[model samples]
Target: MLMKPLIIGQLKARLPIIQGGMGVGISRCNLAGAVALEGGIGVISTAQIGYDEEEFSRNPIEANLRAIKKHLQRAKEIAKGGIVGVNIMVATKQYAEYVKAAVEAKADVIISGAGLPINLPELVKGSVSKIAPIVSSLKATSIILKMWDRKYNTTADFLVIEGPLAGGHLGFHEDELVDIDMDAYQEEIKKIISLKKEYEEKYNQEIPVIVAGGIFDKEDVKRALLNGADGIQVGTRFVTTKECDASDAYKQAYINCKKEDIRIIKSPVGMPGRAIWNPFLEKLTKGRSEIKHCFGCLEHCNPKEVPYCITKALTNAVEGKLEEGLIFCGDNADRLKEITTVKQVMEELTV
Candidate 1:
């Protein structure tokens, strides 16, 4: 069957693919713009977006807010008219400001995850940019929809169901990650679709449901489409692309990774995250080094008590300090063979 265009608000993406947002400089303006140019919805991750700016370590929120417009402008220049969106984590210290920055930058859409974005509608009020909340289950989707409807009299432009196989900060607990079966998620997807239909009927609008996590090739996209998904969000595959903002060493890590290398590690932000097993991770597992001061980014984070500072580790990795940095990747990172351009990768997956 032929794939159809993905509609999010008034924007129509030629390919039903939303490039999953990676943070700490992975999916920056260059990568996102390339994906949009390739006919997909290119997403720029807003996690510590100003890490490259001077003094970001001292004031992350203010730095990131300033960087949002700069990145979006660069992405728009590269896209030349294609759809470009921003993926902001709800757990960030300045979530509201970042969302507003994206809106001000004329971002086509805003995809939020890592927590329930209950006030996302309110944050983007009066903006043309559509809002999408990423969820791990039907219950989360239901709760978000109901809250948005009741509080703001608004509905989501789209929904993203991110499964356990996704990289970075997971919504599920460490134990639940291993225990929950993929088959069970199917029912959850069905329930979310049903809930979406209810809201669509009430609001007289269509809410597109996109499935994410562990999606690799065309076969994976096909499975999602067959299972009631209007599109798919892919992350790890995009990491190996030429346009990705991550260092060459980081992409090489994905290319060289083995199946056993991908494992869940305890993040300093009090959440379980998936990453490639590297020398740094091995050292972390052995508890060899003492963690330095925390950056105080996440609300639940306790730097003095947690394992290590996630922002520092991730920023280090993105800066090419592979030996002492945390390298986040999806379970399918092991399957990647070589580096390719974003245009080539999208063509392979969509065609």
Candidate 2:
């Protein structure tokens, strides 16, 4: 099948693909720009984006806020006018401030998830930046649409269905992930597409639905489009790309792992996440993972009680300290064979 153009709000991409945002210095300017330059929408993850800043340890919030615009600008520059966006998780603290910062920076789009993002439309009010809410089920979709329509008089510019196989913080509970696969989600996608038709007619606008999590290679893309999705969001497959901001050691982790290495663990951010099993996760099982200092990244995190500092673990992985930090990844991470370029990955998927 030929690849279709992905239109979110007024933005258009020649390819029906959005590279899923990987946080903690994973998908930043380099990767996002490269993908966008390739005709797919490129996305930068704003989670702990300032980990490399000089003053990040002292005041992470301010550091992160300062970095948001910086990264977006750099990514846009690299895109050379392609569609570039940022992924801001609703679970992040100072969520409103982050949204405002992205809008102020003239981001092409802002994709939010890890929570309902009920107030996303309100936050992006009057801005040209398109908004996409990430959801795993119809229930969450209904809540976001109802709240946004009733309160803000707007609907999502696009929707991302992050299935059970997604990495990092998942929308579904741990129990729900048990024995579920992509086939189980086809009917739900049909329902969501059906539900979205109402708002499309009411608002008289098209709201593209993108599928994320477990999407890899050309076959997956064909399957998603055939299943009624407008596009697909892929993360794990991009980890080993040269353009990805992750360190070489971090990228190697994706290539070295086997299927059994992948596991879902209870993340400190009050959600379940998929990650590669490593010494770091094993340490968590044997004893308490250290929380040296709070980054104040999440809205509800208590430094005293969180299993570990997510910021630190991710930072460690990004900096090549694989054994010292968590390696958050999708289930397909094990399938990675060698490091490649962003252009090559895009070609393989779209072809």
Candidate 3:
């Protein structure tokens, strides 16, 4: 059967896929625009988006704000009226400012996670940009719905359920990540769907639920739809696509890895993340690596404490300095066998 289109509020994508926003310059305008052009929702990650800006190190905030507009413009140019969105983590230092930037840039949607986005409606107030929150558990989903309903008198345009197998920052605990039961996790997704129905009835709006994490192939997409998700969000699979913004070496890391190479590591933001084990991470495991600079990217980061600079490590990875970088990926990153184009990947997923 052919895949169905995803409808979130007034926005509709010809494909039921939303590319997860990978950060540190991994999924910029290049990959996002390409996906949007193919009738899928393209999402630009706002995390450390200005890393390549000339004044990034000195004026990170201003640089990011400016780049948000620049990159979105480029994505729009490639999209040709297709749906383009931005992903802004709630844990960022200037979370509200980033939301404002995305809205001002005229993003069709704003997907937020890395923390509960209780105040998301307020930030996007009066804007046409739809807001979606990524969640891991039914409790988090319930909390967000209640808060948004009671405080803002609004509901999410859609919801993204990211399981523990996802890359980058996870909403689950370290212990939960290690021994995740697929059946139990699917049950959680269904519970969230049931909870969302209450709000849908109250607000008289459709709340499409998109499932993510470990959704590697067409079968995964079928399973998600059968399990009550209206769509699926994919991250690792996109990294191997030609349109990905990351360098060749970065894509090679995914192509070259075995299933055993994937491991869970501690993120500086006090969350457990799934990434490929590399020499840089191995060195940090033996001892704390020195912090070279503070990018002021995260709300919980302190220059004086924590592990190595996450921004720097991720930047190194995207730049293809594998030995000195942190390569974030989903549990199936190692399953990627070769580089492919975004159009081909989309075709395979929809097939």
Candidate 4:
């Protein structure tokens, strides 16, 4: 077995693996805490963190901020001594507030994506939490590194390269996502590595780069390492785990899904998202359903102009309302065969 501890500056994990953050209440305290307890870094997604709170639909900010501490405290209790991190999307409506809450909750690491986290260092200042940005290309990495360096006099503690094949909202446009060659992405990876090396030379710091999106099994892990990734982030595989916070129906959907059933759908949040084709999606595509509410979660979303409310759809899924909820999954979700525990899944991936 290839077991190399991933060193993200001062933070270290027994396994060079990160449990990719799943949102809309999917990977919560239980899932993240279990992964950390099992030796890998467990990441809680900040996307709709206040998902189950009673006032989430009314006061998303207060609810989400409160949920951050709740989730972090629960994760810490389960972690015992392991690492726990949180993923907050930059495109979120309350990005700064959520990031500050994560820091205040004493999270070990904070991963931001969906846009360049130019102000991450500022949000995390005076805190011990490490900051990382998920980028899909070197251009994005360069832009972030320059901004962080110039503005905050800080370098990234770590970096994540999210490829087009990964689930949920993608960094690339829909057409580019399907049309780009994987071979071309390899160059982007190399450029990011080179950029990391440049910073290493200038600042005399070592920054670890992790790759995510569409990663499955040990074979995928090996491929990522070979491609210069310090570690790997796996998400969809964990959805079917016993410790996963998602509903049983959600897990079963992955197991029962075929490759063709996984398709890209327009998020009311103004981004293209990958999800399992379900009754909810069918209704949205056919314009048979009307969005009853909007949470103003994403900055670009307008309930009046969009097809449906993303917050409502995701919340429904989280609460087990399968027929009316949108279920997000990665490209490899169709390969899931059975549900397992978090420990079992970690062992399989680490091996």
Candidate 5:
């Protein structure tokens, strides 16, 4: 099956591909804009977005808000009218502030996850920016749909189903990740699709289901379409693209990884994350480290209690210190071989 345009609310992408938002300078204006220019939905991750700003360490919220507008403007400049969206996690400390900033900048869309985005509709109410919530199971989809129907009188513009093999923080528990049952998960995706239909009809609108996590090539795209997905969101594959915003060392980490190098570990934000087993993680396995600085990024992050600062570790990775940083990747990172361009990656995945 050939890839087709994905229609999400008022926006449409020539290719039904969304570049999943990888944070800490991974997928920023350069990467997102390049993909958008290629007729796909480009996504910028809002997790510690202002890491490069001079004042970011001193004033995180202010720097991030400023960086949001800066990055969006830069992406729009490169997109040349193509669709460019922002991926803002609901677990972010200043969630409403970030959402409002994206909407204020007139971002094409906001794909939120890391938690249920029950209040997303309300945040982008008067703006033209569309809203999408990422879910890991049928239960989460139902809850968001039900809550939106009852309280917001609206449904998601689209929904992203991130399977267990996704990068960064996963939505699944430790046990589920230990031994994933693909058949059971596929059944869950079908169930979520069924629920999407009910809400689509109830609200008299289309709620497209976009499959994410572990999506790499054309075959994966075909499988998602066959499983009832309107489109697919891809993250890890983009890490190797020349247009990706991360440093050379950061991209090299993904290239150097093997299947055994990938490990499921705990993130300071209280979620299980998949990353390459590095010296930092090896050290973490031995004992907890003292928090050097807290960016006050996540809502539940405790400065005194958490082992280490996620923002710091990720920022280190972005700066090319692989051994001391957290290297996040999808389960299929080991499957990648060489560095490629964004255009090449999109073409390979577009059937």
Candidate 6:
């Protein structure tokens, strides 16, 4: 299959790839900027992004908003005019404000998921930043497209189809994912690609479909393209890259993990997430761990009630306190044996 540049609105990527957005200081200015500079789309995850700011502990909202601009500006500077985007989870507390912040900061693209982004179009109206909704099935694609059309007379600039094998918060339940059928999911992807045609024709524009989850190598990219996807969003493979913002130990965790070490766990935000089996997770199996402080990152999180404090756990892992922090990863993380650069990964996928 021949690689084609992914065009979303006026933005263009030399390769039809996007460095997956990892939160809790994982994919930030360094990784994102490198990906864009290397000719692919770079995405900064805005989840608990303010963790590094001094005001994060006192006023998370303001800190997170400030981090959005701070990171976006720095990422853009490193990008050197290349396309840079932000992944804004709808599950975040100030979802609308984050969307506005990304647009205000002049983000080239805004890909949102972790919940249905029903009001995304409204929040980004009159901005040049392209919007994409991360969906898992045709039903989700239909709902988002229909809702966007009915409510705002617009459609997604692109669509990211995340499958069951994805990391972090997944769209599918744990039960359904245990015996997921890739062939059946590919059929759903075909249908979604077909579904987008209607909206594309109506708006007289193209709506690219990007498949995520389990996409790791050139063959994976080839297969996705042959199956009708315009591009692929990669997370775990990028985690081990030198430019990734996570701590060295965090990247090493990907290299040291075994295939059996990966499994799904219930996130405190009420979603199933995939992560490595570590000391903290093993301890959780015995009983729930109490959260000392709540960052109030997710919209539905309660300080008193939840399996674990997501912000603290993710922050711990990103900072290299692996035993205490929850490290979210894709199923194929075990395949990584060494660290690489973003340029190498992009060339391997597109060459």
Every model's TM-score: 0.97, 0.98, 0.99, 0.97, 0.99, 0.99
* Predicted candidate 3 versus true structure: per-residue lDDT over 1-351, tens digit per residue: 647788887888999899999999998999999999999999999999999999999989889999999999999999998899999999999999999999999999999999999999999999989999999999999999999999999899999999988999899888998888989999999899999999999999999999999999989888889887899999999999999999999999999988888999889989999999989999997877888879999998887888799999999999999999999999999889999999998998994
Which residue pairs in candidate 3 collide?
none
Q: What are the per-residue Cα lDDT tens digits for candidate 5 across 1-351?
A: 567689987788999999999999999999999999999999999999999999999999999999999999999999999999999999999999999999999999999999999899999999999898999998888899899989988888999999998999999999999999989999999999998898888888888889898888788899999888899999999999899999999989889999999999999989999999999999997888778778989999888888888998999999999878999999999998889999999889987
Candidate 1 deviant stretches above 4 angstroms: 288-293
For residue 245, what is the lDDT in candidate 2? 98
Q: Which of the two candidates, 1 or 5, achieves a greater TM-score against the reference? A: 5
Worst 10-residue lDDT window for candidate 6 reads 287-296
| Alpha-carbon lDDT of model 5 | 0.92
lDDT of 3 at 205: 91
Quick one: how many clashes does candidate 2 have? Answer: 0
Model 4 misplacement above 4 A: none
Whole-model lDDT values for every prediction: 0.89, 0.90, 0.93, 0.88, 0.92, 0.92
Measured by lDDT, the strongest candidate is 3
- Which clashing pairs does model 1 show? none
Question: Relative to the unseen true structure, what is the C-alpha lDDT of residue 218 in candidate 6, on a scale of 0 to 100?
Answer: 84
RMSD of 4: 1.3
Q: How many backbone clashes does candidate 3 have?
A: 0
Per-residue lDDT over 54-126 for candidate 1, one digit per residue giving the tens place of the 0 to 100 score: 9787877888888889999999899989999999988888778889999999999999998999999988889
Worst 10 residues of 3 by lDDT: 1-10
79: Cα error in model 5, Å: 0.9
Q: Against the correct fold, how does model 3 do in TM-score? A: 0.99
Shift of residue 118 alpha carbon in model 4, Å? 0.9
Per-model clash counts, in order, read 0, 0, 0, 0, 0, 0
